[model samples]
Target: MDETWAPEACTLPTAERPFRVAEFDDLFATHLRRSERVDPQTLDLTLNPESRATVEDLTARETECCSFFTFTLTGTTELHLRITVPPTQTAVLDGLLA
Candidate 1:
């Protein structure tokens, strides 16, 4: 796994993080339409409507390992995702974008 940016608080096993990251990269490559950093601690993503299941699954597994994230997925036709982390975890969120 690429532990270079992964925070110490992440519970995802070191070996599995690369796979998780690959999934995210694939998701972004395939479905991400737009990405915005709403604030220092928040990120908003716009994805294709066809990405609902993938987003749901990825976010679910992500939260299981990094509970600090708060993800809200909405928009029936367009799929909007809002990801927020607490102030203390802002750096971790930034790592994801990198």
Candidate 2:
């Protein structure tokens, strides 16, 4: 895989909070309302109303560690999170979101 997205310096230490598979699994299992693949490298997630803060917090922390991730939230009554990653990192993104 191309290491372009994995920069040497970042805001958070990856080793401090290694990506936990269960964390994501639980987040999606409990909060996901609907999901769509905006494209091969972008995922659009519409989460339950109550899950907005949780998702925001999670993504915020994620952005600290992996600057490659682009997380955007649009809409108010119904929140949507658009997660974009480099094309070369699709597999890694899939594994994390799966």
Question: In order, how many clashes per candidate?
Answer: 0, 0
In the range 23-94, model 1's lDDT, one tens digit per residue, is 988998999999999999999999999999999999999999989889999998899999999999888788
- What are the Cα lDDT values of the candidates? 0.90, 0.72
Model 2 bad stretches (over 4 Å): 1-19
The deviation in Å at residue 38 for candidate 2 is 1.9
What are the RMSD figures for all models against the true structure?
1.2, 4.4
Cα lDDT of model 2 by residue, 1-98, tens digit: 22233345445544543454445667889988899887878999988778878788888877877788899998777889899988776765675555
Question: What shift in Å separates residue 94 of candidate 2 from its native position after superposition?
Answer: 1.4
As for candidate 2, its clashing pairs are none
What does candidate 2 score on TM? 0.76
Q: Look at candidate 2 and tell me the lDDT of residue 21.
A: 40
